[model samples]
Target: MANTRAAWARSHAKLDSDTIADAIRPLVEADPSIKVKSIITEVQSRFNYTVSYRKAWLTKQKSVVKVFGDWKVSYQTLPVWLKAMTAKMPRSRVQIKTLPVYRESEEVQGVRVLHRVFWSFYPCIVAFRHCKPLVQVDGTHLYRKYKGALLVAIAQDGNQNIVPVAFAIVEGETADAWEFFLTNLRRYVVTIDGVGIISDRHNSIDAAIARSNGYSRTEQEYNKNYQRLQERGEAYMHWCDEIGVDRWVLAFDGGHRWGHMMTNLVECINSVMKGARNLPVTAIVRFTFYRLNELFTRKSAEAHEHVRNGFTYSEFATKRVEESFRRAGSIVVNRFDRRNEVFEVREMPDGSIYTINLAQRHCDCGHFQVERLPCRHVLACCANQRLDWQVYVHDVYKMSKICKVYRGEFVPMGDPSTWAPYEGAKVIANWTLRRTIKGRPKSTRYLNEMYSRDMRGSRRCTTCGKEGHSRSRCPQHAGPSSTGGQS
Candidate 1:
């Protein structure tokens, strides 16, 4: 009996990913994020044999293909999918650039591979018109079978709602790729002039801005801040010079940037969707479509509800205005302009005097013109002059405009069977850009000096009772010390 069992064990068929994946396709369709361990358990329960981790991983990947379609076929069918999207939603912009396929040194005729593609939905393009006149651009890497970068351009609404206006999947953050995205963003999505773009001081970004185009501090204040940095070290000042002040300093930003200095808005979007990067190229597109559709639906409903409730501004804008109004009561306004449009405002007690020029839209405290909202000083000036203050609030803050942001309506791209027949050539994936790194994929993100900076000087020497050197490096740690720092 023992011999028979051993023979049967030796003779049992080994499970390949295709067979396991076929069995798990239904499970994957139910929940795409099902784990490999669960898959291994499922195999053991059904086949009475356990699979190795690698086999389970391979099977899970195969299940992804089965549920979402083949990665290779996804690349081939991408052009059809994009065409269908445009046909369903006219005026939506989609641009795809392809490179000729090369084998060794020779180019293959009629065969092309995807180089980069940028897209902006019609709703998002229109929504930007009502958003703040500033855009923040950011880039993140994609993982798994594909090698590339996802570049995004995002805007902020009066309610501080993040509006993703444009996106591109590109080869990498190369200068050429940035140029393509920047030019397309300006030409298609951000059509208005005088709109500013905020990004990290990448040389690529600098180059892109030269082709395309906040901080709202005063020049004198900026000069003083720079002087303090210079006193600390020349290297500090040199670093500031390397990254031009105009890019970050509000006062020097030419009034185009609305005092925004961080690409954190774009990063926030990227971080929330970090896990989605592992999806196949076509799945990535579908994922973005569904996510944005969800965003627009929820936001549009909220906008309508807010308007119905009699709120004339966004929740965030309304809160800001109310706070300014509360502080305005404590301010004393002195007339400056003969027409009573400008005034000198002094807050009670020790607060400094601020020059509020209603006609010129200038507030020395740097809030009125910067945000286009009536600051406390501006509100005080208006109150003292008996001028209507609501006019000072930018039109972008009005509920009617915020409602227009999502009113364009995202037309759902239904079943492919319902899509019009596509006659265009297939989009081929660049075989050269395929990921080749072996072993369990290492995290592409790396910790930098900033991540560990806080650890510096945090180590305490046990014997010396000091917060500099560690116990191992302490002078008295190993030299006849009977007690530790606490002792």
Candidate 2:
């Protein structure tokens, strides 16, 4: 066997000394115990390297191990062996398995398909600034019982955290829906100053605010904002005047469609309330915001950061309010009215009259709520009508929400190559289950079964086959006393 092995090694050991050292470099660093001999042994197991004859050949070239402890030759020889072996090694490609997609089911209803939302849904600074006390509002269809759809709006605090501020899951996204949203919005807004509301631009906003009699102090404030539209030469202001409610339109920018514009605020809320979108109606009603709170909890860091800053809402607190003031003249708004399950787009006489049906919920212009993005027709209507085009649109996106789902929290485990050995080991000296067998009450199934078997219920040594004697404490062992027993 020795002769045959030597013959095989002699034939295969085609490496020079330098190749050996390189092959063992990683092994020696990974484990300090690994020396030249260890590397040679590993290589010998994997390949028939003729180290014996090569030793002398290396010595003539001043590369052989002179003394037993002289490891330099071993180091130099390793690189040579590795160089030859590396060339000889066959390369094989590996295929990776596809990750399983977790199918949607009842248990994971509110789970989002994309990324988890760690914050409140206020996509734009305008929405964030204007809609304070961040509200998590959502809507669903209720066409079976009523002709309209239901919209639920809830308020949240600085932490992207939520509270049930106000909710109106109504019949349709009409003036009635907007009225409910505004009524709840106003009720919530009155509690704070510089109140900003976040909502999708359902035409109801125009109608709800329009129908108010300039009736109360809140109504008067609303009408005052609306009346500003007229003072600024907005085309929709004339419609408001005709309806005896012209005083309520807070004019948006000119030439922007409401649907395209309001998406910022709506999308933000949509992200946070994502999983709830396809959920059963009852579940949405019960724990919609509750589940949202759980998602926010995962973002404890951001919440803490906001709390540290006094919750001074970054969404809008830093905005240049005057910039909005400067752009008012270029904006326009086309007013709409809910008529017989449809919407009537009331534009200037020079402009066209397009119909937006809230009941069937289709706009003659066709961009009412289907695509969810605003159409140019809406923009044209907005421009020709002189509505604040900005209000019809949503806000700009935030950096944090746009990131990948797994980013921000979990970074890859730091390079294992650079990690040092752990400095300390947890010492569990004498761990043992203290509970008694029969006299004592039953604790667990394992313990109960042990007692039933008429055993003291302690672990025994595997080597000695004796109870109370662990493998470390076997009397047959002729070493120092061992410590502790297994449970």
Error of 1 at 198 (Å): 0.8
lDDT of 2 at 467: 71
Residue 327 error, candidate 1, Å: 1.9
Question: On residues 1-487, what C-alpha lDDT tens digit does candidate 2 reach at each position?
Answer: 5345434534554554556544544553333223345555756765555354344233222211211113223222222322232223212111111112235634333222211001122111112232223344555443111122345554433222333333343334667446646554554333455333544444444544334422222234445766665665666566555644322222221112221223244445445544333222222332333443344345445535544665432343224222434432343443455233333444444555565433343445433332222344444444454544344332221223211111222112244344434232111101121123322123465555556635767776544466776646665443333334433
Q: After superposition, how far is residue 449 of candidate 1 from its true place, in Å?
A: 30
Model 1, residue 334: C-alpha shift (Å):
0.7
TM-score of every model versus the real structure = 0.78, 0.25
Candidate 1, overall lDDT? 0.80
lDDT by residue for model 1 (21-43), tens: 99988887656667789999999
Off by over 4 Å in 1: 1-56, 102-109, 202-216, 442-487
